[model samples]
Target: MRRQDRRVHTYLLTLFFEVLISYIFNQLFYCETSKAALTSMPYQCQELILYGSVFADNLQDLERRLTGLCDPGSTEFHEHDLSFSLRTGTDPDVTIRLRRRFNVDSFTSHQWQFRYIGGPEPDQKCPVIVRKVIDSIAYSHLMMDFVKTLGLRMDYEYIAKGTVWTNGRMKVVISQIQRTEKAGHYDQSNLKRFADSYLVEISACLPDSAEYSATAKQLRDFADQLLPLVEMEKVDYWRK
Candidate 1:
């Protein structure tokens, strides 16, 4: 059998190399952000971020697509998550602010926590709170319903800071929206179309297939339900 000291060194080296390769490949083999959509979404926008990837394009079109899911005919695209700024004491939190198109009740503001923080339970999903804003519409824009998918994937093989750490680089789909004469927005040519996918991509890194299956379901459901709204039109959706 191999000596005990050599065995320990070999094991450590294997782990270190695994993690290093993961980071290098992630940086070098990233997706190209050139997807286009002819149809314009309501409100002028840009992708500041998508999911957890480095994508920071297609904000206007992405917002347009997101709001089209629930109340298709309304001018307000509500109940979605887009990158926005927040502040706790002095720390500026650049977060995806979940907004409701209109409020029904007098008090509907709610709470949310950053999911990327290295806490006790990084795998445990955070609780989505209620975001209520009063308006003619009855739906409360709390708890963003779905996520948009633009067919691009970010691949990685290792964790950034070992097992106790995570990453934030993303594959983004940048797009722009323009209003049409038909009372909505449509891409005249390459209006705006996108596909974004992101993950840590660790082999044998999970609880089980059952857990993985559940997570996959959630992601697919979100993508299927939200992306088509890219053709919507509402000047107010992109604004504060």
Candidate 2:
């Protein structure tokens, strides 16, 4: 009887330790998996943009003012923009813009950019137009093929020659728009001016936790300085 009792006690102790070890291992595994999932999750960003145009004749003046208001030494680029859309009846459901920069007169290497811009929600009280924006750097040469494989059709394309200026988090882009003679083909010689005015866009992209109102106020204050010269205001991109 004594031997049986001793054996029972030893067995109980062994079982308790085994159960505790298993529980500890399972908890460590769960924690690591949770951390991995959190790290892999994609972060969403938002863009606050104010749009306005400067007449061809007033572009020089606008540039001069931008030089004073923005940071010194602007960056210039010649880029081709291609818009791809996926439509499942009615209006297109998904639209993506791919911008490829050609190192023209600059020593920088060529690069491709992919941008997904969501339509701005109609908010009457919001100071600046806010839209969800996802930007990624694409390095693959087969990017166009990959996009086509996904059944997205090219909607429109254009050429943009612009200078970019930055003041802290805010960015100012003044670009001349041009259209290619043939769709999907960007031949420099065949490109023609799309409009007589330069497109002036002042924008800032922020994370989800950013204070959009404060950023919009800063943009408004800077835009106010360029008043009369170029009126930058919230634009309803979908409005006819």
Candidate 3:
């Protein structure tokens, strides 16, 4: 009887450990997949990391720095999104600084931006066409490495459009930014702000009744539904 009891105890212990291992593996896998889903963008960078090793830390910061739609750079200018620039390595030796993430809160007023490498243009309003957008922005900055990196998606379009308010009326227009192809010998490029967006300013032209209110609602709805993945990083990893 003593021998049988010891045997059962050993078996139970082994089973418990096996179950615990299984649970741990499952949790790890779940966390990984969740992280990937949260990032929502491609994991590979010129095939450097195959969407593996994407973790809750550092990864979130990367996501915000890479794709965060809240344009914080433009104070004299307001911003809606960011672009990346790439530098390629061909010789036997080279080093490049890839954008990891930005301090969202710390960035406060000071702005940082990334641009496209080179390629096509983003389809109007189809923000998901990130390949083209990133490519365009990178090329504007003459970045080569960014062109090699694939699987980019821009799901949001936040523009601080210009608006004029006159006679209790408002008119909205697409905002324009001042930028040049000049590389930095001194400082970075400029990212202008859309202090005024069309929807926000357009209602000024309408009568001061609910008619303009509907247009305002339309703009707000468009902002919420039409644009996705604009700001997913709720926490800034660098701070943590």
Candidate 4:
């Protein structure tokens, strides 16, 4: 009986030690993972805007495409939660936006817009805008890739404005305004706006984080994609 008691005690001690070791390892692993997540800076675009022009003739087709994409039942829904609104009167407009959440790491957003320019003039410009938001810097490239698919031209001027803070920087606001064209179907110099031509605007927030360098490079690349469409202008302001 004494020997059996000793054996049972030994077994109990072994099990206790094993459980204690497991608990310690689990705590260490959890701490390490939490620390890594906290230390690793997530790069993301807080906000982004892209401007372009669409013609009246193309309105129906554009609307149809947007509707199809926003439809939850559609296979091409692109895995985004969609919401939309339409306003009509003298100047009609439509807005379609998509959003997705990804904890603290990242989120995705896409917006499509069409607004009519109403005036007495024979020619008026109807503008369409595309805006997006990404919560992480890692998504910068992916977002730009999607932008390229829109066939947007950079025939515009871009400006960025922001302020710096100790804990975090202010959101970067980038605007790409369409320049006045001397001659074209969408010439603005003549004080005439055509539906076929569009103005472009892009805005984004630069997150201040450990990944700032990589994020900046990605942003530059994103802007470069539209360089071919932009007119000569001083963009030094953005660097500062």
Per TM-score, the best of the predicted structures is 2
Q: Write the per-residue lDDT of candidate 3 for residues 81-129, one digit (tens) a residue.
A: 4332221221111111123223223333321233322221223332211
For candidate 1, lDDT tens digit of each residue in 101-206?
Answer: 2222322443222111100122223211111111111121322332112111221111111011111211212222222233212224422223242211111122
Give the range where candidate 1 is weakest over 10 consecutive residues by summed lDDT. 128-137
Error of 1 at 139 (Å): 43
Candidate 4 local Cα displacement, residue 23, angstroms? 45
Angstrom error of the Cα, residue 86, model 3: value is: 15
Error of 2 at 47 (Å): 0.7
In order of listing, the candidates' clash counts read 39, 0, 21, 14
lDDT of 2: 0.71
lDDT of each: 0.25, 0.71, 0.27, 0.29
Error of 1 at 43 (Å): 37
Cα lDDT of candidate 1 equals 0.25
lDDT, ranked from best to worst: 2, 4, 3, 1
lDDT of 1 at 3: 72
TM-score, cand. 2 vs. native: 0.74
Off by over 4 Å in 3: 1-147, 151-176, 184-217, 220-240
Candidate 3 local distance difference test against the native: 0.27
Most accurate candidate by lDDT:
2
How would you encode candidate 4's per-residue C-alpha lDDT over 99-160 as one tens digit per residue?
Answer: 33312223233221211111111211211111222221111213334323433222222111
Candidate 4 similarity to native, TM-score: 0.19
